[model samples]
Target: MASTRPLLLLVLCSLALADAHFKVFNLRGSSLSSSILGHADAYVKVFCGSATLGETSVRNNNPNPWWEEEFTHFKAQQNDVLRLEVHDSDFGFDDFLGVCQRQIKLGTNSHDCFLEKGGTLHYTYTLG
Candidate 1:
């Protein structure tokens, strides 16, 4: 059986729900040391393809802070890995930190993807 990360990005290719997303969390971490689940106090924006799926603005009901506003209602294909581009509030794209290991439902149909409840999927890049 294939691990969930790579499969997340590939699953979308078969289904054309929308082309509004681009990057996928490609950080392949199946253990604790390589997850992207942490806290950042910066303001940023998330792009789905060319469309702004997440922002610190009121339009998307963003509560500010990059993390909270970004992953809200976010969805992913079976193995769609999102390349996370972290940016500064007043600056441009800065770095690629981590990835979101999806934990959706068994019968999930919507584009809305979220980590499973109590299901551990680390979204980190590296552990040092």
Candidate 2:
């Protein structure tokens, strides 16, 4: 079966060459943030129409750090709905580094709701 992580990465890489419709963020390293470097715990949910395609948590190595969750191979599909949501309500306001550009995928409804202003997250997906 086609892996989800590789697929998402491919979509993200292509987004760079296209014209940005929304202009989510300019490529720049932001200054120091006020939040305490908060981390966002997110999961991947795949859906198509009203049916749930699948769901998987971004596995982690250490729970305390919570920033190094490797998303190299996400489990997803073409018509599935994917949502990366902060799992912990408490960590929403904690210190957070901008998401790694290498790990972003601009799929349908793909977006990163970075708290405050430190990183930019957006995606453009073309479904078949």
Candidate 3:
């Protein structure tokens, strides 16, 4: 029937434009800003647009930290912007170290984002 044909076409189109899987891994930071007390207790928050994908655990008393953690988003779209924010955690208030944003791309990608205060954030991502 004509109605059935249109429904089938819509389903096919939806499948063709289905969301992608995005993976973030191999996160590290070097020469980060130091806290007022001493070395920074750093952590990273990953986001896909306004939605939070994941966050790394805080590394205490470390200006340079490497996180052996991975985060994934199963419903990511190619047009989505991936945002990363680095913070230094404190007992009273967390300090904002820096932030980076990248447009989603197919395949594997890497970036070394420099923070606003100081330091470099190294990270890798894969989209499929």
Candidate 4:
């Protein structure tokens, strides 16, 4: 009976701390011309809380870029802040374009928000 009690407690604890998985589908709008030449090679950086999630492929010479990228199996909790930053790719240093942030909440969600400087970013989140 004592052994069964421990096992049952373990099962309950596992269920309590079970991580949640979600998908973030993002699309970005035109960024202001920041390239030294004229057009910008832009990409996005995603962050969950303070941890770096991942970056999208660079869209060269396009101020307006559409990313069908999916962040699958991302671990997050309720009320966590998800941030996105737009940057222009460069040889030595990347130029910062804009940023957007949103808070995670219960249920499936979708948001269309503007970036920091110039441009718009939209996100569709599916929670599991």
Q: Between candidates 1 and 3, which one is better according to lDDT?
A: 3
* Candidate 4 TM-score to native: 0.76
- Whole-model lDDT, candidate 1? 0.31
lDDT of 3 by residue, 1-128 (tens): 25688889999988755787789999999999986688889999999866898899999999889998899988888878999999999888899999999998888999999999899999999988
Compose the digit string of candidate 1's lDDT tens values, residues 1-128.
76898787778754655322323222211211212333222333444323354543311222122232324233433333333333222224433223333333323222322222211222322110
TM-score for candidate 1, please give it: 0.26
What lDDT tens digits, residue by residue, belong to model 4 across residues 1-90?
Answer: 256888899999877556577667866665546555877788888887767878999988887778878875556776778787888889
Error of 1 at 63 (Å): 18
Model 4, residue pairs in steric clash? 99-116
Q: Model 4, residue 22: displacement in angstroms?
A: 1.8
Candidate 1 local lDDT, residue 39 = 29
All candidates: TM-score:
0.26, 0.26, 0.86, 0.76
What is each predicted model's overall lDDT from 0 to 1?
0.31, 0.33, 0.90, 0.75
Which candidate ranks first by lDDT, i.e. highest? 3
How far off is residue 128 in model 2, in Å?
2.3
Candidate 2 runs further than 4 Å off:
1-38, 59-86, 89-121
